[model samples]
Target: MKPLLLLDVDGVLNPMGRPTIDYRRYRCTIGTEVYTVHLNPRHGRRLLDLALSTGSELVWATTWEHHANEWIAPRIGLPALPVITMGPGRPRSEHGEMFKTPHVAAYAGRRPFVWFDDQVWAEDEEYLRVSQGLRDFLLVHVDPRHGLTREHLGMAHEWLTLTGFSQGP
Candidate 1:
């Protein structure tokens, strides 16, 4: 079986911290007071497209939640993916905090995998550090200007090869 690859949409795939003329809800807070939120620069859609083409089972681990599929995916010309929605409040690690690594690892049958996200540090990095094979698992950071740059994708391709996810690099 091919190893799993994790992907991040923000700085890795979609560029945030920029400007957005259009407005769309990116998050929701079902707490004492209900609220809908929008990210500063929403570009997750484009990143979604790039990720899907790779033939990996995609998961949305961002704060966007349902909005990623409801709004962002359509706008960016990408299809809906398995979204890993966060709860109202949850304790997170110092790095790779949001990543549900154990779940992901289980989902992938404990096989090798890769992750691409600008926000992941704790779970993702730690998994890479402790996993059986170092080169089999990879984490790619996408550049904003170039949708999914070749460098990052190429790096993933190499890592995938190392893990037997692909026969050739």
Candidate 2:
């Protein structure tokens, strides 16, 4: 099975706090609520390049859920991608992992995956370790202030390359 590249919108793509000049503000209307997001177009290209080189499929694993396709994808130059359905409410596991942890695991289904999120904690890592034994997975913690950086992508690239999941030089 092809490896997966799991993406989160809030911190990973639409970074919170102050943003750099490279990021552009966008107005997204989800129902009656309007949300402003900061996005860097270059991130889209970089993510696509990384995925292509790694032979990985990008899947959204965020609270935005299907809305990511509507608001996040186009501005970032990505096409429609699969999204991991989040369970209702903000449920925490006994391990204290975030609600998205179990859902991401079920969606990944033993496939090697690279997950980008700011909320990932040690607890999440521990949970994944016990749940997905021997599966190659990389959980990249993207800082909400900086969003996704070249350095972050580099880490993923290096990991994928080392794991024999990358098809590029």
Candidate 3:
């Protein structure tokens, strides 16, 4: 089976800190809430290409959860993907790691995986490395201001290739 590619929407796709005027902003209504998100169409294509090249299965690992499919997916040209159930309430971390770290690792189990999020911390890395003993995983920290750039994709591609996880053409 291909490795899992865990994706976070807010900082990875929607880019947080950029000025609103700089991006192609869209107002989307999910349920009764109207939300504004910034997205670059090129990012959509790049992420899809990356997933194809790596033979990875994309899964939403964001707080957006199912709403990602409702509001974010089509805007960015991604198909509906499986969402990681974080369960009710926040994930509790025993080692001061990011709340999502343990949940993500548990979901990945023994499979190789790459996680894209802005909230990744050194503690999360340590938790994955020392506690989980996972060597075939990558925790890529995307800048909230810029979101997923070509450089981030390049890094992910390089990691996938070097670790023998890539099915690149």
The numbered model that scores best in lDDT is 2
Provide the TM-score for each candidate, comma-separated.
0.59, 0.95, 0.92
Residue 101 Cα positional deviation in candidate 2, in Å, after optimal superposition: 0.2
- Scored against the true structure, residue 136 in model 3 reaches a CA lDDT of 83
Query: In angstroms, how far off is 28's CA in candidate 1?
Result: 12
Model 3 scores worst on lDDT over the 10 consecutive residues at 15-24
| Model 1 spans > 4 angstroms off | 17-55, 94-109, 127-136, 142-148, 167-169
Query: How high is the lDDT of residue 41 in model 3?
Result: 66
- Model 3 superposed RMSD (Cα): 1.7
For model 2, residues 1-169, the per-residue Cα lDDT tens digits are 7888999999888888798888899999999999999998887899999999888889999999999998999999999999999967777677788889989888988888899999998888888888655367899999987788889889998999898877654
Ranking by lDDT: 2, 3, 1
After superposition, candidate 2 runs with Cα above 4 Å error: 132-134, 167-169
Over 50-118, each residue of candidate 3 has an lDDT whose tens digit, in order, gives 999988888999988998888788888889989987788886787889888888888888888889999
Between candidates 1 and 2, the one scoring higher on TM-score is 2
Error of 2 at 108 (Å): 0.4
Q: After superposition, how far is residue 165 of candidate 3 from its true place, in Å?
A: 1.1
